[model samples]
Target: MKFFCATFAMVVTSATQAEVFTYECDTPPLSVWEVAGEWCSPLESLKNGLLIHQVDLCPGWPPPGGQFVFYTRSLADFDGAATFFVQWELQTNGDSSEFVGVCPASLSLGSFGPVFYQIVIARDTAKFHRDDGLPNIYISIAPDVPHTYRLELFGADLYTWYIDGMVVASGVPEGAYPSFYPAMNFGTRAWRLPNTTRWNYIRYGTIPLDAAGDYDSDGSVDEFDLSFFVECLLGEGVPSGPGCGFADFDADGDTDCDDWVAFQAHWTGPPAVPPIPPPCAVVGDTNCDGAVNVLDINAFVMALSDPSAYAIQFPNCPMSTADANGDGAIDILDINAFVALLQ
Candidate 1:
């Protein structure tokens, strides 16, 4: 069937953190999922994942046999300028053609635009099925094994797919339209056949990069990142420019004070590796050597002046305890309270 839909280019915004939505199929949360059609039984949560069984009895029924889709609740709608990513981990028991779809919020049962992007998986091969008259690119993958499928919707009408961490395909679709929300659907495609699929998990977000605060794709977050981070620091809700996503540490949609704190925590000078943050044991032990004394004096000063430097110097210790004044902020106001602890 010809379905109507569109694609969006990633937009620059410092409004809200990209929402990270994840579902583990082992215990599917029915409250957050919606089901459509008959003959397809509700998915059962198993130790392996969520199981979908396709029976052979309903071979020619219209809604029942044609396609049985399970989808998530609604999300905010956006136009062609929005950006997002989705990943699914799954495996099939036998030969099967499964469909995965995403649609806007106002999708209608009869509207062709309901499914913005559709993927068709037949056993060891998969392809993008859109109504835009473009030829589909089929990617061959390892069959019967669990596969990690990722879809990235970036730039205008542009998309890239990764299977098992390898880039398999990239393309742009024509005649795109706006989307209502970021909702997803999964089900059987075409005639129902006897087969089963276990969905291990599904995750999607705005910027789900491997390393947070590392805009340059480098291994560490350093001064090189700070320069770019400054440019992206448009306060909450205001639009940022391209590549600003890296500085959005708190994912609160902006590169403000909150993100700066998180950035300071991750800062590693030059190309050095950042140390794993040490636990905070005592409320005033900024040095993290299991003591609260003069040895912590210099560490406390650095924590208040240049938090990023403090992080690099005391990589194994937490700086949060620098708030000795208990005012919840590490500033000069806490000096008096901090001295009392030292004495």
Candidate 2:
């Protein structure tokens, strides 16, 4: 189904860092990548030790994901008026049929005149026509200087572009497309001298909100989030609670069985809840008062014998931390483990 970004805004923040994979090509590694078109030369290094692609025809390379961050650069000027293009593409089956969820959204940058540089976002429909509402921005930078570019896809819909650390444009395109792979191409409308484009690096990975089992947004996936997820599934609270959208692990807009299955795989722990108590704390200390006395034992017995009854008696505890053995199931095993902890 076609989905579009509901909001568009320029945001700048100095918060959180993403783990990225970096590729620096001091030498040509054409064999590791799929390079297409006859005019494309194998990757070569410039005098400055940066890797570049010098081509007289349209040359393309592809990179994959549904949501990710991509950073690349052009190390030199185009020999003629050729355009450098990067597109998010869907892979096709062996029969040349389009893969599911692939859309043809692309960013094009080039010099229209000696002093003018232009950038445009294009979304191609299934019928191979450009959507009329795409946005374009223009700016001027010195020739032969490296320029940085960044593209971010948030969730499954929002697209944001950046130039030199500043947001240049952002919007949602109309139409359905599968997860995308970055396809980088350099070509001109008319033949000209071979233009060389340097690629400094490309970094791509999952967006945090797109991470599985991170329902609580505490920057980590753990039992607290899982307990909250259970609450969400049971309809015990409002669905719009903070970070509740992370519970929709499948990004399908609803918390259901499918999300549960996805969450299980994404969970980083042993599927146990509340997290282990700290040293000097009792294993079954539901109230966290740091004692192993009668009250703690009573709460454990109640939870083990009758969960519903225990929940009614201690509504705030949730019994997640009560499982002393860290087993996923809460049963006699946990009861014994808790008792052994007291000794």
Candidate 3:
């Protein structure tokens, strides 16, 4: 019941024939689930329309081993600031790629400055952003501009570079950790540690899935956090004040006690919704808006090409303060909506 795909042409480098804007999929109707389990990306057959270089990701895009990368196995204390981001197209012919900030597998391939891989921000029960198993190695660079790197590792010994976001080239240059059998990279690579530089389409992983509610990635964990954990089990969502504690974990809240003892987590692989009650059913969400961007993809393509007899229910999420193409997916990269309103 869903087949929208048209523009797809990728050949960035078969030795530089350079066609870059890829996503034309459909090798012969191969991936067919059209609904439930959600496979669907055969590029939907191509009727000549898929050019979403607005960097699409709805039904399928970036689902390929990308996004959802979380790694922090070893770090006793580096504590700098470390950060992450991805999303491009500054008209992109390739906008001068060099982004590979966050390395630390133990610094060997030209290890320079800023390498902290420690994920123990723990506050535990209070949920201030729990991680506190304690040891410490954070990096956090956000100088903005064209370059920002963070390579580090000490549980084994490796470190690399970062400068505009600050950590200024702190190498250890010798190398280790990467050969786990091919790849699982963090800070994701298009090339930066040793230097290649198509730059970065985006890749990040350090490995942290103790239970995975993804904390609050907002990528998707529907039923609205089990409908806000059944509205915090029926009390109606409480526990706030700082970071990640909407239910203090499995007690009656959003999966927390290590995702509540880690049993039947979610994303069950089917039942994407629809017991029936959705005839375009959004019903004046008052302000909950879901997928419609650029302050709302041309306003839902001009509200479905207006003549608006009426179709309400879209509200929340339309107030981006110009985190500006920072590309972190706070709604498909907060698309600048040309930085103003519509005409």
lDDT (CA) for every model shown?
0.55, 0.40, 0.25
lDDT of 3 at 21: 23
**lDDT by residue for model 3 (1-343), tens:** 0121222322222221111121223322122111211222212122222111111123433322212112121111111212211111111121112222222111111113222232111111000101224322333332222332333332234343332223433334233433222221222111121211112222122311223332233334443233323222222243321112433445444333243223224533124531111212222121224322344444433333431311332221222222234343224333344233323
Once fitted onto the true fold, the runs of candidate 3 whose alpha carbons sit more than 4 angstroms away are: 1-144, 150-155, 158-161, 165-176, 186-343
Candidate 1 C-alpha lDDT tens digits along 1-343: 0011111112233423344445554444464557644334433445534545443324345432333335544434333425666666676643434332221000111123443666666567666554446665677768777776777776357776777656777777443333544456655433434445556566555553432776544445665455446646666666543335677776665667567667767777664533223221366788876678999899999999999999888775667779887777889998988899999
- Which pairs, if any, clash in model 2? 63-182, 101-177, 101-178, 102-177, 102-178
How many pairs of residues collide in each model?
15, 5, 45
Q: State the displacement of the C-alpha of residue 63, model 1, in Å, after optimal TM-score superposition.
A: 13
Per-candidate TM-scores read: 0.50, 0.32, 0.18
Best by TM-score: 1
Please give, for residues 170-214, the per-residue lDDT of candidate 2 as tens digits. 565342111222233321111222234444433332233543666
